[model samples]
Target: MYPASYYYRRRLPGRSRGKGLIICLIVFLMFSTGIGLLKLINIQQAIPKFPLLILGQKGENALNLMCSAMPLLPVSIELNDESNNQSSIQLADILVLRLSRVFRLDRQSPIALLEKELPVPVEVESSAVPVMKAAPVLPNPPSPEPEEPRQAQVPTLSEECLMAVYNTHTGETYALTDGMDRLQGKKGGVVQAAAALEEELEKKLGIRVARSDAINDDVYQYSYAKSKAVLEKLLAENSQIVAAFDVHRDAGKSREESIVNIDGEILAPILIIVGSDARAEFPGWQNNYQFAKKLASEINKQYPGLCLGVMVKDGRYNQFLHPRALLLEIGSVSNSTEEAVQSARLLGKVLGPLIREIYENKQSE
Candidate 1:
């Protein structure tokens, strides 16, 4: 029933009035809040009362600053069990923000305040590790020498002081069990050793000699026993035979046997063993000692270190039979065959001269 223009103007005026009412009400509320806050300010008595809730990362202490500033606050740190996974909670002055430069809070018992400061206590365990050092290395040993070869022929027994030499064992005839009265397998090797020794002896003493078969018939005995028999036989037949010797081998395996190569010749370093059996009883292994020293000295002189050492043992070595009788071990079964054979050749070169000297000494006697 009203005109269209009048209705539009009337609606516009109503909207304006509504907007003005909303703006005036908002301004009044803001003004009232500001006056109330200003009236509540008591500068001297103002103290923050809000409880600070500080959550910290595991193993981290963010409340250290607060603890140092407010030593009397009696704050505490604990792990919160309410969390799905337990988390740490650190305490600080919560109302600190409400104060300006400085403020004082109520002093509380350290134990009680700390307990109320955190929801729960946090437990921590720590461990440390030690450093280690590396181990030291050992030094390597020097290598042994190789065997030497001789091309000289052996002297005939008649050409030397003795025509031929034979050996026997008093207690046990053979060198090993199931002994033979006459030399069997050892005959060739013995002859070879004797020939080598004879060659050297002939060169030094100008004597001719030869080695005969070793008797195997009898119970097996050590080489020393066999050496005694050879000495007795030499005394009975030649009467001038001196420097008798028994040759044998060692039982232990050594590096020299495997690697020693001299001028393409392989050999095991020799071990000159002397019996201490006499040394223990007589105190003067005079004969045996002299014998050992002579052998070691002569070998060292000729070969310049061929002899290992003169090791004294507890056995007589059968040297009691005759001062000239001796026992020698070339090498053990563990040694290469070449090393054993080479040792035999070397023994012959060394012994031949010593035997010739003994024969000459006996002739003078």
Candidate 2:
């Protein structure tokens, strides 16, 4: 009963209908495969790993220490790449570390042990390389007067600085009334961090630290007055108090910035803040810069990416009283108090050494 045309179409077994169906399937499969390959390539192009630029000797020093501890972080260290340019890293299993921060090996620890192990480029060629007999020998420049041996200077903490936490800001007294067990952050306060950083430094570095009144981040007028008062008191009391810090939290969303935690510990990401108050005389940043640079240099060495850069500002966050003060703005209010505390703890670890180095370097000079 089938039509004669249908019989004609089905010319041979596995020849007419079966062959057409097979051809159609092959075309469809090929199209799908092509699309999938393109999609995979696009995804690969989208998620390129971030390039870490470790600049300045301070930053480079910190990375050296970090690499010694954890060798798995994927970074392209451009210390001695032949290009001497911003080299592109091959996204391979190998870690990339770029040493833009130059270190005078003679100044820091031993060159043999540290330098030998690292991939850092060090110029060890002697300046006294013998010239050819035909070349004129330049006489050694007139010898300068011999320098005096210097002693390291230790910073003396002032009594006023010790009592800074006792002052009040917005009706809330700034004091570590309760030790670590009871210190907590108010809705818009950073007393706990100040207290914790101070306490640990005191115990670890044998240096005295004090906390200033908590000031609002938005209101400049009121905040400046309170900040100025604390600075004056510290400077008036302790000439050795080379640094003062104002710690604040940011107001950004949690997703925009977040603190990482491992088990019971919180991971901290500190942001350095510089003010922009143009009205004041002696923005006090130079002194602030000295302290900040010293701290940033040392901490960045101890903990890679832990101590962020020093922010330059035109305003006085009470930094005018002394050049050695800093304003630390940690992650925003959206983050939990625990995150801030975690950051404070990590900060303390490197802060002690940083302070020590600053004082030591000053004395050596």
Candidate 3:
């Protein structure tokens, strides 16, 4: 014979146990949702101060792109007006596109036409309103100056900039893809990333950066000495150059381990190396450390997890030459070239304004 409590439990059929589990699950879900919301809000920043470049890579399928950008779709935020589109993208009304089969319209293509008897021409009463003549067209106003004058001003604006970028380990390469081959020693894949950084700084950020394609590391051990010489020459040539970035790549990681994601886009993690005087005569190492920390913080503020962190090394990795010099590991050997290239653009986005601020301060002094 069973007890009365056992008979009561059998009658309910898990009703009491199910309710407790359901409540706990609901609480867990709510906590998870709250944390996710906080993370999204914390990642948002006011990027209106800089020229906004298209961060997405092309050639990606539409489905993945849509899914990646869905979380960042505008909920309550500010965007540029079409008339004042200083950045690359021009704001416009969103259009929903769908896949469907449609009739082809083209020239020089032969197709059988369906013949139909014409009915007649019917005149409409409101055909020509003639209201446009009453006032000048508000859209597309005449420019005060021609396109030539405006185009010429861009070079003049960026020519005054003093910045330098070069590759210490020019032989460093990354994972390859279709139609993209690896570079031989001397001009490796990392050089393209350095070139991209130089271009982004000049074109997007309006900062002219001198880049050297010299074969620095013909031999592995003397790479630092060769890079130091190159950096010295750059400093000598550009007297006003305040900052120098020596681009390199990290190693000893798998392809999947090397790449990091920020806002759904794949990126190569940036590691800032600040060398100290433990092995060499590096004075004012604290300055470089502080700068690196600030830069890492700024990059994380904009795209969290893209920057690994600032590292202090024992040997002087040619950073002893300049107070603002830094050695940047754009990615590891396992990352793709495209990932490094995109990361270079992101680095320029944060680094340009920081360097520009220092330049302005020096000028004011």
Candidate 4:
């Protein structure tokens, strides 16, 4: 029953009043918070109550922007899980790891602080994932995180690369297990055994062994020829490598016939091969032969006949590269990767004592 203009004007003024009330309430709340924050002069004490107020919140966004153009890294870190704040730390690493994909970071870097640290014992990839992938042929068993592997690195030791190992015929596979005897151009069981030997030696003895993944068996006959080149390069770079082994596989032998009983456990046989001067100019071939003999004797002493004795070949299997260089036929084509790996591990077990002897003696000289 009022005039039309009067009602319209009244409604507009009521809406304006409501908006002003909201603005005033919001300003009052903000002003109160600012005054409360200003009262706390001891900012350090406040950090415990409110962690996300400082670097943990603001630095994360900046870290993401920084690692976008950074290089790959190899990190040696140890995560501290001894506090109740482990969950928060983990959440922080997750946020940072999920934020940027630009860094293939494994090495030590400034951005590494955002991630949890891991010991450089077991092999790790450039990222968080493991480096070892199950071969298509070998049944990928669930990798049990063994305790021994964690206690791998010896506390008192000078970490130096002491030995070099490579596979001349990396394509030699286990036919019974791998569905093929050789992989032609791909890495085979021999390569895996060599890798196992590297890891085992590092774990058990803390000896840094330089190993190669050079695929030299693509053509089979030219394997030695190609591997010689790889060996030359490796030895040239690592001049301190006094000992080298050309890891290979022997064909035409079954699993049963290729094994040796060592300490009640069945392991693949190892054959030490010494090259001759008949094919190539090998000056110190006999020294290598004597070393091979000593190595064979050591293996035999540990587990009699585990080594199939040292075999001297007419061809210079790249033994001419170094005085301590020798060839090792890990197992036959019929041997499984497990057997091969165990055998290689056994070799590492025995080699630790003799290797330390050789190394320490050389260092004294």
- Which one is best on TM-score? 4
lDDT by residue for model 1 (1-365), tens: 88999998877897688767755643443232322221222211221222234334321232442344334322222211334111111111212212211223233322233333345443323333454676777688777776687656644433435523433332221122223323443342334444555555565435654454555434455544655655566566665555556555555454444334444666545666555554545344567668778877887676664566677677766555555455565544445445655665676566666665655576677
Name the top lDDT candidate: 4
For residues 1-365, could you state the per-residue lDDT of candidate 3 as single tens digits?
A: 77999988887788768766755653443232322322222222212211234213232332232224443322211232333332212111101000011122221111100001112122335756544556655788667874553333234233554888998878887755322233446587789889989887888777888789898877878888899899999998888787899998887877677889887898899999999999878879999899999999999999899999999989888888888899999988777888899999999899888878888888889
Model 2 off-target regions past 4 Å? 1-189, 213-221, 260-265, 276-279, 361-365
lDDT of 3: 0.68
Error in Å for residue 2 of model 3: 99
lDDT by residue for model 4 over 70-130, one digit each (tens)? Answer: 2111010112223523443444343334323323443223224223222113324568976
Computed on alpha carbons, the lDDT of every model, listed in order, comes to: 0.47, 0.50, 0.68, 0.70
Q: Kindly report which residue stretches of model 3 are placed more than 4 angstroms away from their true locations once superposed.
A: 1-158, 177-184
Residue 353, candidate 4: Cα error in Å is 1.6
lDDT of 2 by residue, 177-256 (tens): 22222123332335665666777667655667665544432353465676566567666766555456667654444633
Note each model's CA RMSD in angstroms. Answer: 22.7, 42.9, 43.5, 33.8
Arranged by TM-score with the best first, the candidates are 4, 3, 2, 1
TM-score of candidate 4 against the unseen true structure: 0.58
Candidate 1 worst ten-residue window by lDDT = 84-93
